[model samples]
Target: MARLLLLGAGHAHMTVMAHLPEIISRGHTVTAVGPLSRHYYSGMGPGMLGGTYTPEDISFPVQQMIESRGGEFILDKAVRVDAKSKKVLLQSGREIEYDVCSFNTGSSVPQSIVNANATDVYSVKPIENLLAGRKRIQSLADRGKISIGVVGGGPAALEVAGNAAACAREAGCKNVSVRLYAGKVFLRHLSPRVRSLCASAMRKHAIQIIEGSYASGVATKKVTLEDGREFDEDVIFIAMGVRPSALIAESGLPVGNDGGLAVNRFLQCDEHPDIFGGGDCIWFKDQPLDKVGVYAVRQNPVLYHNLIARMEGGELQPFDPGGEYLLIFNTGGGTGVLHKAGISFGGRLAFFIKDYIDRKFMREFQP
Candidate 1:
């Protein structure tokens, strides 16, 4: 039997770890290592942010699930990989030897962005960690009449804008001004209907949708745009660009233009077949898809096949990500917008349906 190590309890590993016995029964040893005892899935994070669901609803026990299948589970971060030796260097100073490895460690914001002068700044990643930062924003918002700026136009940014507004209202902030700042039109990936729905919902919630402008930096509770315009911001959430966790890029692997680790169709590192990857950390050969949770969720099966194949000396399989994955994003006032196949929907019922669908989607992963 070969010793196989899983580097993170991210989306892809969460999917396959639940079925770890299948991998074990095939005569391979498995080890799952990461800092968290459980993984809070990004798919259900918006719900948590909007107060539609509790934290427990969106989280799953990773260590228990993997250990139950007779695999060693270590709650630690992987610092480096010795590809030639087939071993993972753990931050805890332990060395994990493996015959095959897969990485689902995911991505996080740069400390520079969060530690900058922007005290109100927040990055939409590492959902659980975001919660602590969100709480600080919530407290400041409670003081009333807060000018909130969401510094990105993507779905996650949209959700931050919406959730920030919702939390403001929940904290009883009157005259709250929530604005989204993007260098271009918001929700550009969606169809016209979806865009209209999103804007309409933002308007209804008293959230201002500001487009075609970038947030340059913050100074003394004020945000400066690229056009030299200044706006008061009691709270700012930096929802812009994502970088693969620094350790991944530092591993000396081939990477895509955005500095994400380069991988073949099977999510295996192009330069090192024995070392595999998934989630927001990997870049496919053909397209530069964003590090969305949907794409990470889609990588599960291929990662499962390829990891096992590598352990058993079988053929590696290709991962075919769906052409378009659906997204139901929050507008921040107890409402959300839906997007799929260039189509969109809005309104209260739309938000309710979105909640139902998202909750049901995560249920499949529940034990």
Candidate 2:
């Protein structure tokens, strides 16, 4: 039986879990390694902060789901991958041998930036970090003085800033304030209309928008901008871009300029066919994909099929992202904006659509 080892219980891996029964029936053993037993769906993060969903509502109990699907679930972090040796090194000092391996470990903010503002910087990747940051802001707001500084101009930063403002208001803090440091061009990827709507929502929520400069560094009491301006911020959240785990580059794998593992259309590592990766960790050679859940979610089915095909000595399927996907930005208080193909719209209806889609997606992984 071929041994198939999965690194990280990310969204794509969850799809693999859904197909585990068939893979096991075909005579292959499956094992998943990750530090957490539950994987939080990042789509609901804004709602989570807005008090619309709890952690449990957006997370999948991966161990339970994997075990129920007849797969081994290891609660350990994968530190290294010896592709030539077909082995994966875990944090617990165990080396697991495998015939084939796939990575969906996701990405994180650069350590340099984290360290530059370690005193107040909180990342949004782990979900827990954002939650803790939310609680800290709440506590400070309750005490009567709070200022939130968010870095990055992408969806994550916008969602975080908007909902965080709403969270503070819901906590009854009249002294709360939020400021967004949108480097140079804010939401450059989104349509102009969507950008305008987002700006309006931020305005409505009382969040300040500062464009034309990026954050240079963060101090305990304020954040410094590249343009030599400083804002007094009690807390700073770094939602800037994320890069793949250092293990990929450290393992001698071919990577993209952005530090993500380089993969072909088949989703296999270019230099190592037996090794595969998808989701945020992979940089597709044909088309550069944004590090967004929309792309990751689309890769799920393709990764599922290709992994099974590799183990069964069958043909692998190719992945094509096609075109830009729709995006929904929740601005809290039963309001949201939808962006697709350069067109944008929003209202109470948009929020309901977003809530329905997110809830349905989360329900699929429930035991």
Candidate 3:
């Protein structure tokens, strides 16, 4: 029986977990590793921060799901992969030998720009960090006025800024203020119409959108701009986007310019066909994809099929990223900005659509 190793309890691996019984019945052993037993759906993370959803609402019991399906689960972080030895090294000094391996390790927010010792400085990643920041912000706002700073020009920054304001307001803080430090023009990569709608929504929420300069440094309750300006705040969120985990590159595997595991159209590493990956952790050689969950969700079935195919010497299937995906941003205050196929709009209806889709996605994956 061949051994299969799955890394990270991310979107693409969810399908593998669901079909673990079938894989085991086919004479293969499955083992999954992740830092956390529960996998939180990032799409609903902002809602959790804004008190629209609880931690339980957006998380999946990954460990339980794996064990129930007759698969082994390891609650440890993978530090490196010895591709030549066909082994994966864990932080705890454990080595797992696998005939086939796949990565869905996700990504992390770059924290180098922020002071490591700074307090109340949060990164818009790990999803759980937002919950802690929410509690801290609410506790501080319970006393008096507070100013929050959000650094980044992407959708993640907008979501955090708006939801943080909503969180403070829900705590009955009447003097809560939010400022978004959008480097250069906000949403520079998006359509002008989407940018206008987003800006309007920010203004409606009394959020100050600061552009022209990027945040050069982030410290406790203070942010220094590249243009030599400074702003003091009660809390700061560093949403400077995300980067793939360094494990793949550190393991001496082939990677793309973004440091993601480089994979071919079949989602297999060209140099090592037995090694496969998807999600934000992989760079598809055919085309560069946005680091969004939609692509990972699409790669699910293909990864599942190919992993089994490799073991059985069957033909592998090529992954098609598909057509335009619907993009929705829950910008707090019970509103959202949605864009799909050149159609863009904003308001409560958009939020409802996003909410319905997110909840449905959770239901489908949650065991």
Residue range 253-308, candidate 1, lDDT tens digits: 67788677788888888678788888887778767787778788778778888888
Clashes of 3: 0
Best by the TM-score measure: 3
Model 2 earns a TM-score of 0.96
Query: Model 2: runs farther than 4 Å from truth?
Result: 114-117
For model 3, give the 10-residue run with minimal summed lDDT. 135-144
Tens digit of per-residue lDDT, candidate 3, span 132-250: 99999988987779999999999999899889999999999989889999999898989999999999989988999999999899999999999999999998988988899899999
lDDT of 2 by residue, 214-233 (tens): 88876676778888998888
Q: What are the candidates' C-alpha RMSDs?
A: 2.2, 1.5, 0.7
Models sorted by lDDT, best on top: 3, 2, 1
Question: Please, what is the whole-model Cα lDDT of each candidate in the order they appear?
Answer: 0.76, 0.84, 0.93
10 residues in a row with least lDDT, candidate 1: 109-118
* Model 1 misplaced stretches (Cα beyond 4 Å): 110-118
Residue 33 displacement in candidate 1 (angstroms):
1.7
